[model samples]
Target: MNVLVIGASRGIGLELVRQYLDAGQRVIATARDADGLARLKDVGAQTIQLDVADPASVSGLSWLLDGEKLDLALYVAGVFSTGGAISPPTQQDFDVMMHTNVLGVMQALPQVAPWVEEAGGQFAFLSSDMGHIGDSRSSRGWLYKVSKAALNMAVVAAQPDYPRAQFLLLHPGWVQTDMGTSAAALTVQDSVSALRQTLAKHKSSKTIHGCDDVPYLQWDGRPFAGW
Candidate 1:
């Protein structure tokens, strides 16, 4: 199987690359910096230097991936903002969060979705349950929530254009990553393992959970209600 992990410098993305390589699948992973590229290379993944937040950088992705039919393509690049509605986000914070969480996904969709479609694969974007408006509880990271909400809409809207590929908006749960913090519930390994399993299930299913389209799902393969 051929897998492409975008933004694989560290955290969940890096772990995904490691796990897939361990499973003996051919992996191509991307990182924004030299250090990140080195780490991915050390893990035995074919590496690409990429910064999803930059339009010019993302524009060349298709060229790099030419002639490859990806079995799984994951858009895991994201940034978090801690400001609530009352605290109002700064311009820099807003740009960083929105660009990484929403705009970056939009930019890469056109480039990578077709590759996944070619192999009847799964295209997943890492989203958060905090983005679910109906399930909203706290406004701890209101800016991030808004950005992810937009991310959900972007991926779900693009699904119709790539009907052969199963597009999934996934919440990896509260993971123990840089963004999720050490106090989070699930470890990175557990979260990513479950996410891989969920992607496998979606890829093999004709209709997920009896639904014709599965727009949003948890890492454990459960669908999100009112998302």
Candidate 2:
């Protein structure tokens, strides 16, 4: 299978590229810069320079793909920031998070979705459980949560436009990564492994759970309630 992993320079994106390549799949990974890309290339992935926040860069991916059909395309680009009630998020923080997490997905989907649809493949956005309004309790990471909530909406709105492809919003659990930190509940390997298994199970399935009217889903392939 042919796979496309966006924001693959590090963390979950990087792991996804590695695992896909290990499975003998043709993987194309992208990052904003060349940092960490050499490692991905070393692992048998074709690396591309892409910045989802930049429209020109996203549009360039279309030409780079050369109309090659993609079996799976995953958008894993996002940003997070933590601030308590005493110290709220700054304007810069909001802008960076929203641009990368929300607008970036909105812009890239149009360019990448068609490629997946052409091959009857799957397209997914890496969202977070914090985005689930029904599961909300704490006020921490408000900015990050709001950005992902917007991303969920974007995914749902775009689904109807691409009837042939499966659109999923996956929550990769609380992974122990740079963003998730050491205190996170799950390790990156376990999280990615479970997500890969879920992807494998749904590879040929026409229905996308939780995507009929909403786009909230867990990494274990279960739908989020009250979404």
Best of the candidates, lDDT: 1
User: Which residue runs does candidate 2 get wrong by more than 4 Å?
Assistant: 84-88, 204-215
Write candidate 2's Cα lDDT for 160-197 as tens digits. Answer: 78877888789999999999999999888888998998
| TM-score, model 1 to reference | 0.95
Residue 9 Cα positional deviation in candidate 1, in Å, after optimal superposition: 0.8
lDDT of 1 at 172: 96
lDDT minimum window of 10 residues, candidate 1: 203-212
Every candidate's lDDT: 0.89, 0.85
- At residue 55, give the lDDT of candidate 1: 94
Clashes of 2: 0
RMSD of each: 2.1, 1.9
Best by TM-score: 1
lDDT accuracy of residue 206 in candidate 2: 59
